[model samples]
Structure formats: structure tokens, C-alpha cells
Target: MAHIHLGEGSFPLWALVLWTLLGVGLISAVVYRVRKGGIKTHQIALAGIGAAASFAIFQLNIPVWGGIHMNLTGLVGILAGPLLGALIALVVNIFSAALGHGAVGLLGANTLVNASEAIVAYYAFKTLMGMDWDVFPASASAATLGLSAGAFLMGAIIVISGVNGSALPRGDLTVAVAGLVGLNLGVAVIEGLLTGFIVQFLASVRPDLVGLTDRDTREETTGVTA
Candidate 1:
């Protein structure tokens, strides 16, 4: 209900083809990585956990103007890393589709959009850490950036599909884009604060789950050891 649920006719053939290729490539890469990493039992369990969490949370519709839901994309990326995060997104989308949440025709497109969010969040968090920012600010900014990107992509998909069918009114694309941006920006702010606080708590209580160390903290620890 939250995601764009454009049915079979919404996307052009070229767009569908492109999205399918992209999804396949990404999935292949993740599978290769997991294979190379030796596929530990714990790793599989962790990935299952992330996928289940994403699937469950994705179903909780909030009934905003655009029917937005709590995505938790960035949080999963922070915990699972980019590859597993992307996999989780696809799994969630597929499962959601089964329950009449998102459209089966848009599966590839939806997977690309959500997977990109996870990748962005993971890399942005690492970049912020490399710049010596603390965990909370880094995570919050990453979540905001990731969600903003997802929002933009979602708007684009809606506009393109709508335009293809002349379903939108004259110049309504601007209004749609603006509305999505504004709505997502508000959601991003809330998610940012939530991610920041949750990350802080995880860092203190279960750094193993966070799997991140502040550069400054690491350097200090190194110096102490030296």
C-alpha cells in the first residue's frame, strides 16, 4: 500500500527490461559475494532476520497523503551491509507482493529503488565514519540521504508511468514530484532521528550488531595500545 503499485501496463517494455537486468545483476553479485565469504550459518541467520524485519515493517501502512510507510531501509543497510541489504529489499518486495501490497509487475523496479537506498545508506555511513563523525550523526545523515534518494526515484517512477498513459493532468508532474519530495523530506527527518538514537543505543549495548567503529574511537584505541 505504501509503495508505488503500478500494475503490468504502467512501465514501458524498455523500462521493465532494464530493471530486470539490473536486479539480476545485483542479485548475482550478492550471491557471488556470499559464496566467496564462505556462507557461515550465522550469516545466513542474520540475513533471514533482516529480510523478515523488512517484510513485516513494510506492511505497516501509515496512510499519509501518499500512503507512505516506515521503510527502515537504511537501518537494515546499516546492520546488513550493502549486499545483504539489497537482498533483503528484494525478498521483502517479493513477499509483500504476495500479500497484495506491491504489484508483481513492478517487482524489478521496486527492488532497484529499495536496493539503491540500502547501498547508499551503507556507503554514506562508511564515508561519514571515515571523516571521523560519531555513529549517531553519521547514521542519521545516511538514513536521510538514503530515504531522500528513494523518494526521488519513487516519484520518477510514478511520473514516468503516469505520463506514459496520460493519466496525469497537465503539469501535475511538478505537483506530484513536489508532493513526494516534501512528504519524504518530512519522513526522512523522523527516520534520521530514530536511526541516530537507535544506533547510539546499539553501539553501547551491542556493538557486534552495529558492526561499525568510529574512526576517532578506533584511532584513540590504537594510540592507547601503541
Candidate 2:
């Protein structure tokens, strides 16, 4: 929900290069981990489906917070796992840029923003579930937390990069970005609820698809043994 809408040349050359390099590094690490760990066949299938869904949702522009949109990156991370989820973010941004939805130059910065959401959400959800929380509450809380993280990261990138050609001073820019971040938090609650319902429905019918079966089995076994 925190996609940057700035056009090309919005950031200075140094900022662009710096962000691009960082993004490349992140992707490279993810690729190496995926190769070393070897993804399961089901996870590969899930990644494909998550990529398609994430791309589709990325296109639906909701007219809020100066034209924001839902990315569903949290759900993608939850279903596809972090490594594949990060890849899905890259793929969705690439397609979006190709279609004129986002600027091609900011792909690196944007990828980092969306990827953080997925990564945080996946870990947060797992942690909450491990603490004996119910699926709906845990998933919903994790999704909200994930979106919030993306929103803050988006604000930080904008502030640090300092948009070129903008007349506002650094202090003013930080204030403005803070306002935008607040608006995004509001949007996150709505999107988070939507994600929660979708995940809960999937868990009800296909627990294995969401990686809930193993958790459930372990809990049941512990109860019997205890």
C-alpha cells in the first residue's frame, strides 16, 4: 500500500545508484538462499500464484493518501515465504513499471519497501501463531504490522533520498512525509482486515496451503503427550 508514484529523475544520481545497488544486493542474497535451501515444489507453485495475485492487486489504485494502492505483499509472504515473496515484489514492480503504473527508475527503492512488508509479515505471523494466538487475530495483526513497516520504510527512503526539484526544506519534507505515513497506516488497517479474511478462509479449507497443518499437528501431539 506504500508504492512511490514519483517519476524518473525524481532522486539525485547518487541516491538512485545507492538504492539500486542496495536492491541488487538484497535480491542476490535471496537468490543465493533459495538455491542453497532448495524450494519445495508446492512452494514454487504457491509463489507463481502469489506473484499473479500480487501483480493484479498492485494495479487497483485506491484514491486515498494521495493515490495509494494495495500490494498484498503480506499475503504473498505468508503463502509463498520470504525468498519467493521478495521475488514476487520485484516481478510485480517490474510489470507495473512496464505498464506505466510506476517509474522504472525507482524499482530498487520500491522493491525494498514492498519486500520488507512481506518479510516482516511472514515472520510476525509465525511468531504470533507460535504464541498460541488464533489464526484470524495473528494473521490480521501480522498483516497490519507488515504494512506499517512498509509505510515507514517508504517514508524513510523518501526523506533520505530528498526528492529532487522539491523546494521544501529537509524539516518540511520530513513533516510532509510523516503525514503521508500516517495516512498509509489508516489504509493498512483496511487492507490488513481484507488479508486476514482471505488467509483465514484458506486456513479453514486448506491448512497445508498456508503452512498451518504442521503447527496444528505439533500442538495436538503436545496436548496428547502432556
Candidate 3:
């Protein structure tokens, strides 16, 4: 949802290099962590499924807010965990760029934007669950917050990088970006509700799939003991 649809050279050369390096650094760290910790077979399968779903949704641009699309990165994060979710973001963006839906050069910036949503959503979901919030509300709130974070970050990046060949002043550009971010927040709500329903359904049918089995079991045992 936070994709920058600008062309290859839309960003200044220096900004391009800087964002690319930062994106690379983030991926490198994730890779190292993955290697050190090792992912489960199920997680790898989830990652594959997430990447496919994310890529499919990425192409179906809604005709609102300058044709924004839902990333579903929040849902991905919740199901697949943050590391795999971030990787899914990268993969989806790369495939989208290949199809000319997004700028190839802006992969780094876009990946950071989407990956942040996944990472934030994953932690937020865990935090809410830790507080004993129900699945529907927790997932909905986490997804909304995650998408909102990405929207603001997208605005910040655009403002900081300064669009090439644009006549808009810095102040005006910031304001414009803010408007776009605001629109994205509106879209986030709709997507969040949908995610909530899906997560709730999954939790009901397969708690283990959503990492809820242990919590549910513990609660059941406590009730029995009491």
C-alpha cells in the first residue's frame, strides 16, 4: 500500500544509493538472523504461500488514493513471523517491479516500507495477544497500526528524498505527502477488518496455524485445575 510508483530515476542519485544500501543492510541482518536461528519447515512453507498471495494482491490496484493496493503484509507477518514476512515483502516487490507495476530502482525504498508493516504488525499482534485481547480485535488493530506506520514512513521518505524534476516546494511537498498518507490510513481500516475476520476464522479452525494452540491449551488446563 505504501509503494512509491515513481519511475526509475524519480529519486535523486544520492537518495537512491542511500536507500538501496539501507535496504541491503536490513536484508543482510535478516539473513544472518535466519541462518543463526534457522527457520522451521512450516515457516518456509508459510513464506512461500505468503509471497504468492502478496504478489497476487499487489497487482490488483484499487481505483482509489491514486490507485493504491492492499499489501496484506500485516496478515503475512502474523502468520509467517517477521523475518519471513519481510522476505515476502522483498519478493513481492521484486516480482511487481519485474511486471512493471513498480519501479525497479525503488525496490529498496518500497521493501523498507512494506517490510516495516510486517515487522510492526507481527510485534503488535504479539503484544496485544500477550494482553489477552481476542483474536479479531488484536489482529485488526495490529494490521491497522502496521499499515499506518508504513503510510507515515512513505511520506517521510518522499519528503526527505525530494522528488526529481518536481516544481513543488518542500513545504507543499510535505503537505501533499501527508494527504496521501491520510488516504492510505483510510484504506488500512478496511483491510484491517478483513484481516481480522480471516485471522479469527483461522484461529477457530486451526489455532496452531496462528500460533494460538499453546495459549489456548494453557488456558484450558488452568480452567480445569481451578
Q: Native-vs-model 1 lDDT?
A: 0.76
Give lDDT: candidate 1, residue 166: 54
lDDT of 3 by residue, 64-114 (tens): 655688979989998899999888989999989999988889999999999
**How many residue pairs clash in each candidate at the backbone level?**
0, 0, 0
Off by over 4 Å in 1: 38-43, 161-164, 213-217, 224-226
Worst 10 residues of 1 by lDDT: 1-10
> With candidate 2 superimposed using the best TM-score fit, by how many Å does residue 119's alpha carbon deviate from the native?
0.2
Q: Residue-wise lDDT of candidate 1 within 73-178, one digit each (tens)?
A: 8877877788888888888998888988877878877887888788888889889977878889999999888877887787776666553575678477768666
Candidate with top TM-score is: 3
Q: Mind giving the per-residue lDDT tens digits that candidate 2 earns over 1-226?
A: 7888889999899989988899899999999999999998999999999899889988889776567888899888888998998999999999999999888999999999999999999999999988988888888888889989999999999999999999999999999999989988898898889889999999999999888999988878889552
Which ranges in model 3 have alpha carbons more than 4 Å from their true place?
A: 224-226
Reference-based TM-score, model 2: 0.96
Ranking by lDDT: 2, 3, 1
